[model samples]
Target: MALAFEGKVAAITGGASGIGLATGRALLEGGATVVLVDRDKAALDRLTAELGKNCLAQVTDLLDAESCDAMVPEILERTGRIDILHCNAGSYIGGDLSETNPATIDRMLNLNVNAVMKNVHAVIPHMTERGSGDILVTCSVAGHSAIPWEPVYSASKWAMTSFVQIMRRQMLPHGVRVGQVSPGPVASALLADWPEENLRKAKEAGALLDPSEVADAAIFALSRPRNVTIRDMVVLPSTFDI
Candidate 1:
């Protein structure tokens, strides 16, 4: 059977590593042209080299509106049309509600929530004009079930989940599909910064999920027929709960 993404064009934020990188690879293998955006120039360059000519790497800081605006036009110039968008950039900060500093919370919300909204806003006009597009956001299990020590992180993810849900309904009539994937404890470099104690606790609880697992889920969601929309999906290790 042929891949569903053949001849499609996709734009992915944070596409240099982890789940984002995995998803980009899946899209390319399925015959889609991919625009990979990330903050790390070196990583983007490396990935672009690996993915070859069909992939375009743009060094972008999604936290800034100016950067996102500039990115969409460049993508349009290159690909002409965007068939799918994967808003997958995010960061995790662990702290109790009382210990969370205002600055830390601001940074988390700006990148996790505001950046996703800005990218969506910048891209929607073009998608709506075409009257068809698919949006897949990388939310987290924290959105559905709060993690006690990671209060701010949970809040940011919850906001992303809510935004995707609301947009799915509003965009449906415009011939656009909006969906979200929530992954639990994925094995990525994001875990590198976790405190040793927390890392141990997570491991004791269970093994971390593989990034490819979530990537596969994303591909599945985007490949569904136009009339079939997956509003939300949760991916977790078999041992994970809540």
Candidate 2:
């Protein structure tokens, strides 16, 4: 497993904190060059110091199409190649659909759905041409279920769920693998938008997973033998329900 990641280069969005950060650390320890992609420069600077050599940062705003599109070429220029692309950057907005702010909808959908596709679109050419690469997205259990409380969020994930499936087939013939790691309620910044009662109850019920847990699943998927494709791995806290 260690040898599998050695000499590999991985570009991860939302790489400054949460699951992305955890995965970046794991990959670095395994001898892979990890590119931390996020809009937070301060966090990226701090992480670069802690993560040491093998770790790089791509300070990008996923919400902006041009910024998002430009990251792949930028990383390729810096690293020469990207063996792994983890589309893990995303935002969360919950509660009644009627209450969803117009601007928030644009931001969340753009980040969660559009940015992911745009990033993938940019990488498709390079990976297909090279004839090898692994692409994984940070999906959600919400994507697998309707979860009425957050319809818009679910709607976005549903789009992702379908996109991942179709993209996998498209990339399969090109020797590039595509998949997703869908996790349940994770103790990450995404919960900052969750209601207080919901967060408290999720914690009390032991229903929230740590970012490292999700990172483990992600690495597991990425480390598998080229012949074995882990299309989707859904991880949930043992106590989590629905």
Candidate 3:
């Protein structure tokens, strides 16, 4: 049986929009307290309020190690507990490696790779101490396959894929479950960065998914019975093949 959400506290990074936002909405429906962490102050605040009393918002730029590290501690203090964490904040950079800027590489790595590691590191001690918790990272199908169009993006997710595997093994003994939700071409703001022609092509081909569908996969992983760990829920539109 899937776990119930009552009284659980979930902190979602990048919770202001896209898959993160969709997950927050679903969790709230299940009666969990949702804390949305995002650097976009306006969107964070607006969505937090719109989500009503069960939701909390924190403005954090995960690129800043200090700000990123401070998130869990502060949230734990306020909420009194953090039962779940969804590391969903990330940026995308596509095209050939030669066409991508070195600075862009650093920025994407800082947010996608470094920040995610730091966030997991910060929360591990607490979750381990409690001997119970759930951590899920938002990953991509690109992490599993080498896509020619987005080398850097692929590299970052591949790094996270490895991290999730190692962390799951380590956290298991402590009773915390670590997993990731991998989705292919979700209909989210992330798609806005794609070339117009490519975006249109994906849509016409029915290769794009709604964020809610991705959110449903995430909820599925989190909702599994504690005795069972749904480590990797790789969701894809039937027509999306890279």
TM-score winner among the candidates? 2
After superposition, the stretches of candidate 1 with alpha carbons farther than 4 Å from their true spots are 193-195
RMSD of 1: 1.5
Best by lDDT: 2
In model 2, where do residues sit more than 4 Å from their true spots? none
Worst 10 residues of 3 by lDDT: 1-10
Residue-level error in angstroms, candidate 2, position 140: 0.4
lDDT of 2 by residue, 1-242 (tens): 56569999999999999999999999998899999999999999999998898899899998877888789999999999999999999998889878878999999999999999999999999999999999999999999999877888889998999999999999999999999999999998898878788888899999999999999999999988899999999999999888
What's model 1's TM-score?
Answer: 0.95
Instruction: List per-prediction Cα lDDT, in the order shown.
Output: 0.87, 0.93, 0.91
Query: 112-184 in candidate 1: lDDT tens per residue?
Result: 9988988898889999999999999999989998888687888899998889999998898899999999998
Give the TM-score (vs. native) of candidate 3.
0.97
Deviation of model 2 at 101, angstroms: 1.2
Candidate number that wins on TM-score, 2 or 3:
2
TM-score of model number 2: 0.98
TM-score order of candidates, top first: 2, 3, 1
Predicted candidate 3, C-alpha RMSD: 1.4
